[model samples]
Target: MSKWTTANIPDQTGRTAVITGANTGLGYETAAALAARGAHVVLAVRNLEKGKAAADLIVGRSPGASVALQELDLTSLASVRSAAGQLRSEYDSIDLLINNAGVMMTPRSTTKDGFELQFGTNHLGHFALTNLLLDRVLAAPGSRIVTVSSTGHRFVRGIRFHDLQWEQQYNRVRAYGQSKLANLMFTYELQRRLHNTQTIAAAAHPGGSKTELTRNLPRPVAALSSLLEPLFQDADMGALPSLRAATDPGVLGGQYFGPDGFGEQRGYPKIVGSTDASHDADAQRRLWAVSEELTSVSSPVI
Candidate 1:
């Protein structure tokens, strides 16, 4: 284990990788790295214009990188369904489904479906997309589903079972934490469900990478973060954990990857442990059931 980096990613030629939010930040870096390695990369993004630009940049950098774009807005279930349908119709198999897009702490708001914004976009949206595309992923040999969670998952005590949508008192930090925690729980549960299949589920976190995700932070917090920006790793470095989790031949289902530096914030990727709360089997199952009910999407594997 000589520090897992993009160099460790096995040849991905012929593989189809669909990365949500691939237009920028960690998603952009992840897509660029995979495309450079010869994977047919799909930029699943909300803004088609930015996605095209990202695709162009990838092709420009890699010379012959294969990149495509699909319109997707996680805040809208209809958009998620449409994107998944279009993908299914185009690609017979998907080797990698990276749930990499997310919204961090933001003011209380609701999605088109009337769910809290962060929880809706960061957790429930990806949940539905993963289920809708599970068949295609399963069809591919040695496929993988990698969800990008966060170290922020440790900020919350647990999933707010009673007030998951924050209809009561809305704290942006806790809401974001709940969504991230849901991400890890989802991965662990998905791995359990996919045990009989070749497809496995894993998770990764960028570990305080400087990315556009911080745009939604409050003014004072944003100012403070900006002052501390030098301490944060750039998006390219941040993407290593996800790249490793997605393409490392030795990765196991249910494993998580993150930076190996102080506080797991700025170093190369390595297998890391999540909070004890994240490992609560009952909570994971409950969250899965609730996610299905909320999104109205059934798990394809089950």
Candidate 2:
């Protein structure tokens, strides 16, 4: 296949896209590219001021770009609900819902709901957001839900059902891996649930891109990142796989997209595969059940 950059993104005219964490890094690049291509992009961020700033930047670069801002704090279930309600009221149909906002290897902490921070923000948060907006997304013609995961998922073998939240002891990297793994599992299960609908579910990874997500990395990891910064892809390149997963007409449900470079890092976007554990249907189902129980938000699609 020829190189698939943002330039290859087909016309997004008339589509409405909701991108979490659109204020910076990969999410910002994703929002900007889609807006430039004629999509009315909503920057669903935790901070309104920052969201507006991102919107301004996008509009500045791409004249006539329709970019809006909406506040969404993924760590808080209430915030997610409010954001979803506001979005549903505004858009009759949502063409794309990108579950892209996430936290990395932070010190052990819990979210507003008392769940593990990384797992809560990265997986459960998006899980709730996507379900809350499922109706709107399903209403839209050929809608797509793209969840952003990471190569770090290889760090964990599978979901630790016994200690899903890492409450006993939290190793930052391991927790991060579990959360990302949950992201893939969530996507897989959601696709299965929505198989009969026009709304499809897919996933993508940024492939070791330089982004603000590294702020929470461990000291050693941070130091290593600094040394390897030169090899990391820029945010725009990192956002390509997500862009492809969300807009690629040929993309199918349950498929994953990532970089084509060595070890699936730092290159053009392409359809990629996930770990065997990630493809475990039984585990995916269990995660979904646990998620619905934890968040008390169930998808009508299921």
Candidate 3:
């Protein structure tokens, strides 16, 4: 079979897609591709100004593309709730919920909710948003929930349940790794819960893409990343794994997509494997339980 590309994305006409952090990078590319294919794309962003700008850009590129915006800040559960409520009120069903926004390695900080910034924004934020809007997702036929993880998931051993908040000691890299690992664990657990339903949960990684997500990288790391910039793909190419996972008819629950090149970086999208730790059923469940406790949001499917 030919390698999957944007051309292979099935007709998404009449579908409603909500993509978090759609103002730039892989999310913007994914939103543009889907909107071009006729999906009513909702840009759930933290900044309405940037969101509007992105929407305008998409519409400019694809005349008549249906694009909307919703203000969301993952660091605050209140914002997630507000965004989900507004989305539920406007759309009867959500065909796609792309949990694509995230924070990379940043200095020790807390969210509006007092959790570690990376874990709070990247995992808990999406966790709450997903649960809040799960009903709408389930209402749509053949719907999907796609979370964007990263190759950094392999950098950590597993979820640091003991120091989930990183109050003990802080390490930017490990925290980010835990959050990305949580993303995969959440996807797996969600798929397990949705097994009897039509909606499936899948995940993708951008695989060494040139995007703003690296803005939080420490100066030394950022300098090294700049030195190795030649190996990174552009945002459009970075989005293919996510696009394929969202629209490919062959995709199944619990599957992951990433680049096909060396080190799973900078190439065509293809089905890929995550760390064995990511697939541990017990770990997935534990993370789900802890996420619920932290976010005070329960899975609608359970």
Best by lDDT: 1
lDDT over C-alpha atoms for residue 7 of model 2 = 80
Q: Against the true structure, candidate 1 has what lDDT?
A: 0.95
Which TM-score value belongs to model 3?
0.99
- Candidate 2: segments with Cα more than 4 A from true spot: none
* lDDT at position 174, candidate 1: 85
Query: In candidate 1, what are the lDDT values of residues 1-302, reduced to their tens digit?
Result: 96877887889999999999999999999999999899999999999999999999999999999999999999999999999999999999999999999999999999999999999999999999999999999999899999999999998989999999999999998899999999999999999999999999999999989899998997887888889789999999999999999999999999999999999999999999999999999999999999999999999876
lDDT string for model 3 (183-296, tens) is 999999999999999999999999999999888898888999999899999999999999999999999999999999999888999899999999999989999999999899
How many clashes (backbone N, Cα, C below 3 Å) per candidate? 0, 0, 0
Q: In model 3, which residue pairs have backbone atoms overlapping below 3 Å?
A: none
lDDT of 2 by residue, 1-302 (tens): 67998788889999999999999999999999999999999999999998888888999999999998899999999999999999999999999999999999999999999999999999999999999999999999899999999999999999999998898878999999999999999999999999999999999999989899999989999999899889899999999999999988899999999999998888999999889999999999999999999999987976
User: Residue 89's C-alpha lDDT in candidate 2?
Assistant: 96
TM-score of each: 0.98, 0.99, 0.99
